[model samples]
Target: MSLAGNRATMQSGIGMIEVLVAIVIMVFAMFALISMQIVALRYQKTAHLRSMASQFSADLADRMRGNIRGAHDGAYNLSRQRYPALGDPAPSCPGPGSCTSQELAAKDIHEWRTGLGNAMVGGWGEIAGSVADGFTVKVYFLDMLAAADGATPVARNCQPTAADPVLHREVSCYAAVVSP
Candidate 1:
Protein backbone atom coordinates (compact mmCIF):
# COMPACT_ATOMS: atom_id res chain seq x y z
CA MET A 1 0.00 0.00 0.00
CA SER A 2 1.12 3.57 -0.61
CA LEU A 3 2.53 5.54 2.38
CA ALA A 4 -0.46 8.00 2.37
CA GLY A 5 -3.00 5.15 2.36
CA ASN A 6 -1.34 3.43 5.36
CA ARG A 7 -1.32 6.73 7.34
CA ALA A 8 -5.06 7.27 6.76
CA THR A 9 -5.93 3.78 8.05
CA MET A 10 -3.87 4.27 11.23
CA GLN A 11 -5.49 7.68 11.95
CA SER A 12 -9.02 6.24 11.63
CA GLY A 13 -8.21 3.47 14.11
CA ILE A 14 -6.83 6.03 16.62
CA GLY A 15 -9.98 8.17 16.36
CA MET A 16 -12.27 5.15 17.05
CA ILE A 17 -10.19 4.20 20.13
CA GLU A 18 -10.53 7.74 21.50
CA VAL A 19 -14.31 7.72 21.06
CA LEU A 20 -14.61 4.39 22.90
CA VAL A 21 -12.55 5.77 25.81
CA ALA A 22 -14.84 8.79 26.12
CA ILE A 23 -17.91 6.57 26.27
CA VAL A 24 -16.34 4.50 29.06
CA ILE A 25 -15.60 7.67 31.08
CA MET A 26 -19.15 8.92 30.71
CA VAL A 27 -20.58 5.61 31.94
CA PHE A 28 -18.42 5.77 35.09
CA ALA A 29 -19.51 9.35 35.77
CA MET A 30 -23.18 8.42 35.61
CA PHE A 31 -22.62 5.55 38.04
CA ALA A 32 -20.93 7.87 40.50
CA LEU A 33 -23.82 10.35 40.39
CA ILE A 34 -26.39 7.61 41.03
CA SER A 35 -24.40 6.30 44.02
CA MET A 36 -24.26 9.80 45.54
CA GLN A 37 -27.99 10.24 45.12
CA ILE A 38 -28.69 6.99 46.99
CA VAL A 39 -26.36 7.97 49.83
CA ALA A 40 -28.07 11.33 50.24
CA LEU A 41 -31.46 9.67 50.55
CA ARG A 42 -30.25 7.36 53.31
CA TYR A 43 -28.79 10.27 55.27
CA GLN A 44 -31.99 12.27 54.97
CA LYS A 45 -33.99 9.37 56.44
CA THR A 46 -31.55 9.09 59.33
CA ALA A 47 -31.86 12.80 60.11
CA HIS A 48 -35.64 12.59 60.27
CA LEU A 49 -35.63 9.55 62.56
CA ARG A 50 -33.14 11.11 64.96
CA SER A 51 -35.21 14.29 65.18
CA MET A 52 -38.31 12.34 66.16
CA ALA A 53 -36.42 10.50 68.89
CA SER A 54 -35.05 13.74 70.29
CA GLN A 55 -38.54 15.21 70.43
CA PHE A 56 -39.88 12.19 72.29
CA SER A 57 -37.19 12.42 74.96
CA ALA A 58 -37.76 16.15 75.39
CA ASP A 59 -41.48 15.68 75.83
CA LEU A 60 -41.05 13.44 78.89
CA ALA A 61 -38.51 15.80 80.36
CA ASP A 62 -40.97 18.68 80.19
CA ARG A 63 -43.69 16.54 81.70
CA MET A 64 -41.52 15.58 84.66
CA ARG A 65 -40.35 19.13 85.24
CA GLY A 66 -43.92 20.37 85.37
CA ASN A 67 -45.05 17.76 87.93
CA ILE A 68 -42.72 17.92 90.92
CA ARG A 69 -44.92 15.72 93.04
CA GLY A 70 -44.98 12.94 90.52
CA ALA A 71 -41.25 13.20 89.95
CA HIS A 72 -40.50 12.85 93.68
CA ASP A 73 -43.12 10.21 94.37
CA GLY A 74 -41.64 7.66 91.91
CA ALA A 75 -44.83 7.75 89.89
CA TYR A 76 -42.87 8.85 86.82
CA ASN A 77 -40.46 5.90 86.89
CA LEU A 78 -40.93 3.39 84.06
CA SER A 79 -38.61 0.55 83.04
CA ARG A 80 -37.71 -0.37 79.47
CA GLN A 81 -39.67 -3.62 79.29
CA ARG A 82 -42.86 -1.99 80.51
CA TYR A 83 -45.09 -0.09 78.11
CA PRO A 84 -48.49 1.45 78.64
CA ALA A 85 -51.28 -0.34 76.81
CA LEU A 86 -52.36 1.43 73.62
CA GLY A 87 -56.13 1.33 74.08
CA ASP A 88 -56.11 2.06 77.83
CA PRO A 89 -58.07 5.20 78.60
CA ALA A 90 -56.24 8.25 79.97
CA PRO A 91 -57.30 9.14 83.52
CA SER A 92 -60.22 11.48 84.04
CA CYS A 93 -58.22 14.53 85.11
CA PRO A 94 -59.76 17.53 83.44
CA GLY A 95 -59.29 21.10 84.63
CA PRO A 96 -60.49 21.60 88.23
CA GLY A 97 -60.61 17.79 88.67
CA SER A 98 -59.59 16.41 92.06
CA CYS A 99 -57.10 13.87 90.68
CA THR A 100 -53.83 13.56 92.60
CA SER A 101 -50.47 14.30 90.98
CA GLN A 102 -49.75 10.58 90.79
CA GLU A 103 -52.95 9.95 88.87
CA LEU A 104 -52.07 12.66 86.41
CA ALA A 105 -48.66 11.11 85.89
CA ALA A 106 -50.25 7.86 84.78
CA LYS A 107 -52.39 9.74 82.32
CA ASP A 108 -49.32 11.55 81.03
CA ILE A 109 -47.48 8.30 80.33
CA HIS A 110 -50.44 6.84 78.49
CA GLU A 111 -50.82 9.86 76.28
CA TRP A 112 -47.11 10.05 75.57
CA ARG A 113 -47.02 6.40 74.51
CA THR A 114 -49.88 7.02 72.15
CA GLY A 115 -48.07 9.94 70.60
CA LEU A 116 -44.86 7.97 70.08
CA GLY A 117 -46.68 5.03 68.55
CA ASN A 118 -48.36 7.35 66.09
CA ALA A 119 -45.24 9.29 65.15
CA MET A 120 -42.62 6.51 65.09
CA VAL A 121 -42.15 2.97 63.84
CA GLY A 122 -42.25 0.40 66.70
CA GLY A 123 -41.83 3.16 69.28
CA TRP A 124 -41.04 2.35 72.93
CA GLY A 125 -40.03 4.56 75.84
CA GLU A 126 -39.27 4.56 79.56
CA ILE A 127 -38.55 6.92 82.48
CA ALA A 128 -35.93 5.60 84.87
CA GLY A 129 -34.37 7.02 88.09
CA SER A 130 -36.09 9.56 90.34
CA VAL A 131 -35.94 13.17 91.50
CA ALA A 132 -33.57 12.26 94.38
CA ASP A 133 -30.76 11.26 92.00
CA GLY A 134 -32.39 12.78 88.84
CA PHE A 135 -34.45 11.07 86.13
CA THR A 136 -33.75 9.45 82.74
CA VAL A 137 -36.17 9.30 79.84
CA LYS A 138 -35.45 6.81 77.04
CA VAL A 139 -37.36 6.52 73.79
CA TYR A 140 -36.87 3.55 71.48
CA PHE A 141 -37.84 3.67 67.81
CA LEU A 142 -36.99 2.34 64.35
CA ASP A 143 -33.97 3.97 62.67
CA MET A 144 -30.87 3.21 60.62
CA LEU A 145 -28.55 2.23 63.46
CA ALA A 146 -26.07 -0.55 62.72
CA ALA A 147 -26.07 -1.93 66.28
CA ALA A 148 -28.37 -1.65 69.27
CA ASP A 149 -29.69 -3.76 72.13
CA GLY A 150 -33.14 -3.20 73.53
CA ALA A 151 -33.05 -0.84 76.55
CA THR A 152 -29.45 0.27 76.15
CA PRO A 153 -27.80 2.46 78.80
CA VAL A 154 -27.52 6.19 78.23
CA ALA A 155 -23.74 5.89 77.80
CA ARG A 156 -24.10 3.46 74.87
CA ASN A 157 -24.15 4.54 71.22
CA CYS A 158 -27.61 4.77 69.64
CA GLN A 159 -26.58 4.91 65.98
CA PRO A 160 -24.17 2.48 64.42
CA THR A 161 -21.46 3.26 61.87
CA ALA A 162 -22.39 2.97 58.20
CA ALA A 163 -19.46 0.68 57.43
CA ASP A 164 -21.50 -2.28 58.60
CA PRO A 165 -23.91 -4.10 56.26
CA VAL A 166 -26.87 -3.23 58.50
CA LEU A 167 -28.66 -0.69 56.38
CA HIS A 168 -32.06 0.37 57.68
CA ARG A 169 -31.64 -1.07 61.15
CA GLU A 170 -33.57 -0.15 64.33
CA VAL A 171 -32.29 1.46 67.54
CA SER A 172 -34.17 0.17 70.54
CA CYS A 173 -33.19 2.86 73.04
CA TYR A 174 -32.43 6.58 73.65
CA ALA A 175 -32.17 8.21 77.09
CA ALA A 176 -32.25 11.68 78.64
CA VAL A 177 -31.48 11.98 82.34
CA VAL A 178 -33.09 15.05 83.91
CA SER A 179 -33.01 16.75 87.34
CA PRO A 180 -35.96 18.97 88.16
Candidate 2:
Protein backbone atom coordinates (compact mmCIF):
# COMPACT_ATOMS: atom_id res chain seq x y z
CA MET A 1 0.00 0.00 0.00
CA SER A 2 1.05 3.59 -0.59
CA LEU A 3 2.33 5.58 2.46
CA ALA A 4 -0.79 7.83 2.34
CA GLY A 5 -3.11 4.77 2.39
CA ASN A 6 -1.10 3.25 5.24
CA ARG A 7 -1.45 6.51 7.26
CA ALA A 8 -5.24 6.56 6.63
CA THR A 9 -5.57 2.98 7.90
CA MET A 10 -3.66 3.82 11.10
CA GLN A 11 -5.98 6.85 11.70
CA SER A 12 -9.17 4.86 10.95
CA GLY A 13 -10.43 4.37 14.58
CA ILE A 14 -8.94 7.63 16.06
CA GLY A 15 -12.07 9.69 15.27
CA MET A 16 -14.34 7.05 16.88
CA ILE A 17 -12.17 7.00 20.05
CA GLU A 18 -12.18 10.82 20.20
CA VAL A 19 -15.96 10.86 19.86
CA LEU A 20 -16.28 8.34 22.73
CA VAL A 21 -13.96 10.40 24.94
CA ALA A 22 -16.02 13.54 24.20
CA ILE A 23 -19.22 11.72 25.11
CA VAL A 24 -17.73 10.59 28.41
CA ILE A 25 -16.60 14.14 29.20
CA MET A 26 -20.04 15.47 28.36
CA VAL A 27 -21.65 12.91 30.67
CA PHE A 28 -19.42 14.00 33.54
CA ALA A 29 -20.21 17.67 32.88
CA MET A 30 -23.92 16.91 32.86
CA PHE A 31 -23.64 15.12 36.20
CA ALA A 32 -21.76 18.05 37.68
CA LEU A 33 -24.44 20.45 36.45
CA ILE A 34 -27.16 18.28 38.00
CA SER A 35 -25.31 18.23 41.31
CA MET A 36 -25.01 22.00 41.28
CA GLN A 37 -28.74 22.31 40.57
CA ILE A 38 -29.57 20.10 43.56
CA VAL A 39 -27.38 22.17 45.84
CA ALA A 40 -28.99 25.38 44.59
CA LEU A 41 -32.45 24.01 45.35
CA ARG A 42 -31.42 23.01 48.85
CA TYR A 43 -29.92 26.45 49.55
CA GLN A 44 -33.05 28.10 48.19
CA LYS A 45 -35.20 26.18 50.63
CA THR A 46 -32.90 27.09 53.47
CA ALA A 47 -33.10 30.77 52.51
CA HIS A 48 -36.88 30.64 52.41
CA LEU A 49 -37.00 29.11 55.87
CA ARG A 50 -34.61 31.71 57.22
CA SER A 51 -36.70 34.49 55.69
CA MET A 52 -39.84 33.13 57.34
CA ALA A 53 -38.09 32.98 60.69
CA SER A 54 -36.94 36.58 60.28
CA GLN A 55 -40.42 37.73 59.36
CA PHE A 56 -41.87 35.93 62.37
CA SER A 57 -39.28 37.46 64.64
CA ALA A 58 -40.06 40.93 63.28
CA ASP A 59 -43.76 40.33 63.69
CA LEU A 60 -43.31 39.43 67.35
CA ALA A 61 -41.17 42.50 67.85
CA ASP A 62 -43.81 44.67 66.28
CA ARG A 63 -46.47 43.11 68.46
CA MET A 64 -44.42 43.73 71.57
CA ARG A 65 -43.77 47.32 70.53
CA GLY A 66 -47.48 47.81 70.04
CA ASN A 67 -48.00 46.68 73.63
CA ILE A 68 -45.04 48.20 75.41
CA ARG A 69 -46.69 47.93 78.78
CA GLY A 70 -47.16 44.17 78.52
CA ALA A 71 -43.64 43.79 77.22
CA HIS A 72 -42.22 45.71 80.11
CA ASP A 73 -44.26 43.68 82.55
CA GLY A 74 -42.53 40.48 81.31
CA ALA A 75 -45.77 39.22 79.87
CA TYR A 76 -44.25 38.00 76.62
CA ASN A 77 -41.60 35.87 78.28
CA LEU A 78 -41.78 32.26 77.07
CA SER A 79 -39.60 29.29 77.88
CA ARG A 80 -38.00 27.08 75.24
CA GLN A 81 -40.27 24.21 76.22
CA ARG A 82 -43.40 26.32 76.29
CA TYR A 83 -45.63 26.05 73.25
CA PRO A 84 -48.77 28.12 73.44
CA ALA A 85 -51.72 26.19 72.14
CA LEU A 86 -52.99 27.11 68.69
CA GLY A 87 -56.15 29.30 68.53
CA ASP A 88 -56.32 29.26 72.29
CA PRO A 89 -58.51 31.86 73.97
CA ALA A 90 -59.06 33.50 70.56
CA PRO A 91 -56.33 36.20 70.61
CA SER A 92 -58.73 39.11 70.78
CA CYS A 93 -59.76 41.84 73.20
CA PRO A 94 -63.34 41.78 71.90
CA GLY A 95 -65.53 44.84 71.17
CA PRO A 96 -64.99 47.63 73.72
CA GLY A 97 -63.97 45.15 76.42
CA SER A 98 -60.33 45.96 76.98
CA CYS A 99 -57.93 43.20 77.98
CA THR A 100 -55.31 43.58 80.68
CA SER A 101 -51.59 43.72 79.85
CA GLN A 102 -51.13 40.06 80.69
CA GLU A 103 -54.19 39.12 78.68
CA LEU A 104 -53.00 41.05 75.67
CA ALA A 105 -49.61 39.48 75.99
CA ALA A 106 -51.06 36.02 76.09
CA LYS A 107 -53.16 36.81 73.04
CA ASP A 108 -50.17 38.07 71.15
CA ILE A 109 -48.13 34.99 72.03
CA HIS A 110 -50.93 32.66 71.09
CA GLU A 111 -51.39 34.31 67.73
CA TRP A 112 -47.67 34.35 67.09
CA ARG A 113 -47.17 30.72 68.05
CA THR A 114 -50.10 29.70 65.92
CA GLY A 115 -48.54 31.44 62.96
CA LEU A 116 -45.20 29.80 63.61
CA GLY A 117 -46.71 26.36 63.81
CA ASN A 118 -48.63 26.95 60.64
CA ALA A 119 -45.68 28.29 58.70
CA MET A 120 -42.94 25.89 59.76
CA VAL A 121 -42.17 22.27 60.45
CA GLY A 122 -41.80 21.61 64.18
CA GLY A 123 -41.66 25.38 64.66
CA TRP A 124 -41.55 26.99 68.09
CA GLY A 125 -40.45 30.20 69.75
CA GLU A 126 -38.73 31.07 72.99
CA ILE A 127 -38.59 34.46 74.69
CA ALA A 128 -35.66 34.43 77.03
CA GLY A 129 -34.33 37.06 79.46
CA SER A 130 -36.54 39.99 80.41
CA VAL A 131 -37.36 43.52 79.32
CA ALA A 132 -34.83 44.90 81.79
CA ASP A 133 -32.04 42.74 80.39
CA GLY A 134 -33.32 42.90 76.80
CA PHE A 135 -35.51 40.05 75.59
CA THR A 136 -34.03 37.46 73.23
CA VAL A 137 -36.64 36.20 70.83
CA LYS A 138 -35.68 32.82 69.39
CA VAL A 139 -37.45 30.84 66.72
CA TYR A 140 -36.67 27.14 66.48
CA PHE A 141 -37.52 24.54 63.86
CA LEU A 142 -36.33 21.21 62.53
CA ASP A 143 -34.13 21.29 59.42
CA MET A 144 -33.04 17.94 58.08
CA LEU A 145 -29.86 19.38 56.64
CA ALA A 146 -28.83 21.25 59.77
CA ALA A 147 -27.87 18.36 61.98
CA ALA A 148 -25.99 19.18 65.13
CA ASP A 149 -23.36 16.65 64.07
CA GLY A 150 -22.17 19.11 61.40
CA ALA A 151 -23.88 17.52 58.46
CA THR A 152 -24.64 20.86 56.87
CA PRO A 153 -22.96 24.15 57.72
CA VAL A 154 -25.03 27.31 57.62
CA ALA A 155 -26.12 30.33 59.64
CA ARG A 156 -27.99 30.09 62.93
CA ASN A 157 -26.34 26.76 63.61
CA CYS A 158 -27.90 25.07 66.64
CA GLN A 159 -25.20 23.76 68.89
CA PRO A 160 -26.17 21.09 71.34
CA THR A 161 -25.44 21.90 74.95
CA ALA A 162 -26.19 20.37 78.30
CA ALA A 163 -28.91 22.97 78.63
CA ASP A 164 -30.42 22.23 75.22
CA PRO A 165 -33.91 20.75 75.23
CA VAL A 166 -32.96 18.21 72.56
CA LEU A 167 -29.37 17.10 72.38
CA HIS A 168 -27.64 16.40 69.10
CA ARG A 169 -30.58 16.94 66.83
CA GLU A 170 -31.24 18.77 63.61
CA VAL A 171 -32.55 22.01 65.05
CA SER A 172 -32.15 25.44 63.43
CA CYS A 173 -32.53 28.59 65.45
CA TYR A 174 -33.11 32.21 64.46
CA ALA A 175 -32.67 34.68 67.25
CA ALA A 176 -33.35 38.41 67.61
CA VAL A 177 -32.80 40.57 70.65
CA VAL A 178 -35.87 42.78 70.95
CA SER A 179 -35.91 45.65 73.42
CA PRO A 180 -39.62 46.12 73.00
Please give each candidate's TM-score. Answer: 0.73, 0.79
Candidate 1 lDDT, 72-119, residue by residue in tens: 888887643343236767788877467688887887888888899888
Q: In candidate 2, what are the lDDT values of residues 54-134, reduced to their tens digit?
A: 899899989999888889888887544443234455666774348988888888887887789889986777676677788
lDDT of each: 0.68, 0.72
- Which stretch of 10 consecutive residues in model 1 shows the poorest summed lDDT? 159-168
Backbone clash count for every predicted candidate, in the order shown:
0, 0
- Highest lDDT among the candidates is held by which one? 2
Q: List the residue pairs that clash in candidate 1.
A: none
